[model samples]
Target: MDQKKEIKKTNDQIINSFSTELQTKVKTSISIIEEAVARYGYEGLSLSYNGGKDCLIILDLIHSIATGILPTNLTNPEKLKEIVLFYLRDEDDFEEIDEFVNTSLRSYDFRNYTKFATNSLKQGLIYILKEYPKLQGIFLGTRTADLKGRKQPIFAPTNGDWPESIRISPIMEWNYSDIWDYLLTKKVSYCELYDQGYTSLGLKSQTKQNPLLKQKNGEFLPAWVLSQKSSERDGRILSLSNSSTSTQIH
Candidate 1:
């Protein structure tokens, strides 16, 4: 199948797999996004994607909503064409994540709308906003369980000289299990690092296979195999400490 057809098929499958309750939540989220698009115009909005599972879910939601499959009253189909996507490529990023991002861009036909930069996320956003002065909002995949994500509202206005844009977190209420369920049920492809036990991803120097999922034969299980939410970030933290120690020794 062609890329567009494959993308539509995947989105249709995701919409079909939504449970009744999830369907309601998804509709509400779509409405929120549609309203934002209407108020700000697509040219004034952007998506902050990090090639993570949560961001992938948000992308799916946006696609479904924009294609009129989520039961929203949004009428501007062309609006989707104007909203740009930004990805911050860390210097030490995992190669698997980079591959996944490239695949997703082709599958979703976002090659023209996506921008990638190796600088800090803040700097990248600043550059984009400067290029498009009308940009007033950015959609994010931040969940409440994340450290800086706790207590974030669905729509948050920024302060200071950083861009005068609103931060939108549509999936802030979702948990780790909710994300996994949606991704698995939708048959969406994710970064290969997850299958190698990297639950919470970061730079390669700050991420490692989850020790809890390590087998006696020395093979590591997938991140989804972890039974506890508290252990999700264990591998990242451990890797950070290891890197710190190595730096001190050198």
Candidate 2:
């Protein structure tokens, strides 16, 4: 099939698939997390929440489902427990975002990594897990469609450096619209970036305004908009599931 035709087919699928996948992903995520906690007998699990809209949604679902198993729901805005919420930002801007995640959030672990690149979020998590080996599993809000590098996805058995604690992503199949709809329905509080024109939210420097919000061709783009030659992708550092992995193109 031609590349253009494939894009069209996927775009059409995003509409119906968005809602269907959103619910499915949430349920799937819940089941996986519960199973891990039940089998491993963990008191709590850690999440690398980036203070974005999708992260907020993941926190909500985790709180709702994992409460039964772990008895430690970090995402619950009401319980106000101290679960770690990690931030990767420049030293200059850390104060404000830290305050927001702390004061605004009812419960959090409240960890920050300054001087390290945002890509270090993964490495930081690895370090934390290594230090505190009791943590059974980890959760993230990464969806397949959000990252261009993750088109055809494998839900189970996702590989990572921190393999001891099985990695779980509840919203793995959700589309952008599905995220928004779920947020609206659940009334979860998220960062205000989504309302402002930004499609993919990340560090202040790395994030870009959505190209497709105003144009048809711009939607569903990966969060990182900077284009580089394929050769350069190798040198770039990327983070996923609280672990840093090299992007080596063969």
Best by TM-score: 1
Best by lDDT: 1
Show how many residue pairs clash in every candidate, following the order shown.
0, 7
TM-score: model 1 vs. ground truth: 0.82
Pairs in clash, predicted candidate 2: 83-108, 83-109, 84-109, 85-110, 122-242, 122-243, 212-218
lDDT of 2 by residue, 164-238 (tens): 554556676666566667666555555554454555444444444554433465444332222332211222233
Name the 10 consecutive residues with the lowest summed lDDT in model 1.
241-250
Score each candidate by Cα lDDT.
Answer: 0.70, 0.47
* RMSD (CA, Å), each prediction: 6.2, 12.0
Question: Candidate 1: where are CA atoms >4 Å away?
Answer: 1-16, 114-116, 148-150, 238-250
